[model samples]
Target: MTVSPLVWTLTVALILGMLVYDFVFHARKPHVPTMRESAIWSAAYVGIALVFGLVVLALWGGDFAGQYYAGYITEKALSVDNLFVFLIILATFRVPRQYQEEVLLFGIAFSLIARTGLIFVGAGLINQFAWVFYIFAVILLATAGSTLKEALKGDEEEEGDSRFIKLIRRIFHTSDEYDGNKLFTHLNGRRVMTPMLLVMIAIGGTDLLFALDSIPAIFGLTQEVYLVFTAVAFSLLGLKQLYFLIDGLLDRLIYLSYGLSAILGFIAVKLFLHALHENNLPFINGGEHVTVFEITTSLSLSVIIGILVVTVLASLYSPRGRAMSVVSATEMLSERYLQLPADATDSQRDAISRKLARQLQRMPRISDSLKDELISDRRHYMELLHEVHGEHLDYLSARQSSDDTSSAESAELERRKTAFSDIVNPAAESVGSAEESVGSTAPEGSSEGRPQHH
Candidate 1:
C-alpha cells in the first residue's frame, strides 16, 4: 500500500509539533523531574504511540498495524539500551540534574531527524538492490554477538571518551564548568563551548550509530517507508521521560542485553530468510529467487514481547542484579555529590548528601573491593569538603573585617557560611562516621581543627 504525500506531511507535522510542545512546555525551564512526574509523562507518551498504532490499523489494516507495533517495540527496546550510554555521558560531564532534560530532549530531536533521513535512504537501497538485506543481516548479527559478549562480561564503565569527543576537545576551546544549560559560555573574556555542548555532541554521535542499527532492524520487519518512519519517531517520542523514570533502575535490568541480543539475532535470521527469497547474486542459486520459510509479523512480535517479559522478570528477581544496581547507584551518587557546582543551593547539596549517606548504609551488601573503593571515595570527598569549608570561613572572616564590604557581599557570605555549617560540615562528618562504622579510619589531617590548604 502506498501512502500519499499528504499523509506523510501531516504525520511529520504532528511529530514535529509534539517535539515543539515538549521543548516549550516541559524542557524550557530546567528542573529535575520527580518520580511521579517522570512516570506520568512517560506513560502519556507511550499512550500516544499506542493510539497512533491503532490509527495505522484503521487506515492500513491489521497487517500494517502488526508491522508498526513490531517495529516500534524493537526500536523502543533499542532506545532503552542506548539510555545506558546517555547516562554515562551525562554523568561523565557531571551535568546538573536540572539541566539534564534539555540535553535528553535535544538528543531525541536530533535522533528523529537523522533516523528519518536514514529510513528514506534505506528505502531507496531496498528499491535499487536486492542485496541490501544481506548487509543488514550481517550488521544485526554482528551487533547481536557484540551485545551478548558485553552482557556476559558484566557491566563495563563507559568514560564518554570516544574518539569523536577527543577530537572535538582538540578542535574547540571548551569550558570545564557548565554555565547553566547554555551550550556556549564566556570564560576568561572569551566564548567557549561548554561541557553541555560536548555531551550533546556525544549523544548526537551515538544517535547516528544507533540509527545504523535500528533502521536495518526495522527494515527487516517491514519495508514500508511510512510505517518505518512513524515507528521510529514514536519510539523516540517519550524517551527523555523514560530515561529519568528508569535511570535509577537501569543497572537492575541485568538481562536486558541478553534479550536485545536475542531479538537482534532473531531479526537477522529473518532478514537472511527474506534475502534468500529475493536472491539475486549470481554465485549462488543461479541469480534466481529462492523460496524459503519466512517468519510472520505476528510471530516476530510475540517472540520479541516474550523475550522482554522474561528478561525483565529474571533481572528484577536476580540477586546479582540487585547487587550490581546498588554498586552502580553508589558510584553515581558519590560522583554527583562530589561534583556539585559552586553555585548549587544548600538544599540541593543536602539532598545529594542524604542520598549518599543512605547508599553508604547499604555498603555491606556489595563486594568487599567495591565497598573499599566507595569508602575511599567518600573519605576523599569529605577531606575536599572540609578544605572548601575552611576556605569559605576565611573568605567570610575577611569580608567581615573589610569596612568597604557591600550589602550584597555580606549577604552572599552569610549564605555561604550557612551552607557550610548547616550542610557541608554535617555531610563531611556523616561520611567520616560512615567510614569508621565500616571499619576504615579517617585520613590524618582531615579533622575539623586541622588547617587544610589547596
Candidate 2:
C-alpha cells in the first residue's frame, strides 16, 4: 500500500493540532473532569477515529480497510489493558485526582515517542527478516500466559514498582510525596525528583514493554507499517479522556484481563503461522513453503470485536462487577465529597450535592434516611474543616506576632549591652592609668620609711 507524503503530512499536522487543543483546553487547567465533560470528549475522539477509518475505506480497497479496522480494534483493546496498569501506577503513587490528567497526558506523550521508535524498528526488522515473526509470536505467547496466570489468580492490585522504577529510586534522590504535579521540587535548598517523575518513567517503561506485544500483534494483522502506526496512534489519541470516563468502571471490568489474554493468544498463533508460511530459515521445513490455513483479516476483525463486546457485557452483568461497582461508587463519592473545598464555587457544591442525591436514590441497599443523614454529615464535616482552617490561620498569625515582639526585645537588650560596654571599658582604663602615675611619682623609698612607723 503506497501512502502519499501529502497524506502523511496532513495526518501528522492534524494529530499535532488535536494534541495542542487538548493541552490548551482540557489538560491546561487542573480540575477533576465532570462526567459530562469526559463523555463528550471521549465520544468525540472515537467518532473522529471512525470517520478516519471510513476515509481509508473509501480511498483504499476493502482489503486495506479491513486491515486498518483489524489493527485499530486490536490496538484499542490493548490500550484498555494498558489502562489498568496505568491506574495501578497512579494509585500507587497516590497521585491527586486533579493532577491525574496531567500525568496521563505526559505519559501518553512519552509513550508516543517511545512507541514510534519501536514501530520503526519492528517494521524494519519484519521487512528484512521473516524469522522475526517467530520471536514476536513467542513473546506474545509468553505475555498471554503471564496475563492468564494473573487474571486467574484474581489479583487486582499491581503491588510494587518495576525494575526501572526501583533503579530510578536507587540512583536519584526522589521524594516520597507529590509536589502538586511537579516532577521536580526543591528540598532544603537542593533540587530533588518527586514521585511524579518516577511515575512517568514507570509509565513509559510499562508502555514500552506492552509495545513488544502490541507492535507484533498489529503487524500480524497487517504488514503495512502505515496502518500499524496510524492504528496505534488513533487508538492512543483519546486514551487520557477514556481513563477519566471509565476510571471507576474500569475496576468493575474484572473479566477484561482474561479477554485480553485470549486475544493475545489468538494473535500469537496467527503470527507463528504467518512466519511458517514465509519461512526463510534453513532448519524450518527445509526452507520450503509450509502452506497453512491463513486467517483472513475480516475474520480476525470480527473475532476481536465479538470478544470485546461479549467481555464488556459479561463483565457488567457478572456478580463481582455488580457488587464492586456499588462499593467503588460509594467509596469514590465519599472521598470526593469529603475533599470538596470549603470555598468551593456554588455550582461545584451543587454538582456534588446532586450527585450524592442521585447515588442515594439509586442505591437500594442503603436507606433514604441514612443517605440524607450522610449528606448532612458531609456538610457538617466541611464546616468543621473550614473552622479548623480558620483557627490554624489565627494560631499562625499569633505565633508570628510573638516572634516579632521577641526579636524587638532582643535588639533592645543588645543595644543596652553595647552602651554599657562603651562607658565601663573607658572608665576602668582611666582608673588604672591614674593609679600607675600616682605610685610612680610619690611611693618608692618614702613609702618604705613610713611603713616602719606603722
TM-score, every prediction: 0.80, 0.76
Instruction: Tell me how candidate 2 scores on lDDT.
Output: 0.73
Question: Could you give candidate 2's per-residue lDDT for residues 238-344 as a string of tens digits?
Answer: 99999999987886787888888888898899999999999989998898869998889888898888888888988898655664565456446545555656565
Q: In TM-score terms, which candidate is top? A: 1
Candidate 1, residue 304: Cα displacement in angstroms equals: 0.4
Pairs that collide in candidate 1 are: none
Across 1-454, the per-residue lDDT of candidate 1 in tens digits comes to 7799899899999999999999999899899898899999999989989999999999989999999999999999999998988988887787888999999999999999999899999999999998999999999999999889988875554647788888988988999888888889998998899999999998898889888899999999999999999999999999999999998789788889999999999999999999999999998699999989999999999999999999998888776666656656655665555555667675776575566546545545555454354344656645555554454455455665579888887787677556545554444555555544233322222334533432
Model 1 is weakest, by summed lDDT over 10 consecutive residues, at 437-446
> Which residues of candidate 1, in runs, are more than 4 Å off?
155-159, 334-454
Root-mean-square deviation of Cα positions for candidate 1 versus the true structure, in angstroms: 6.7
Cα displacement (Å) at residue 44, model 2? 1.4
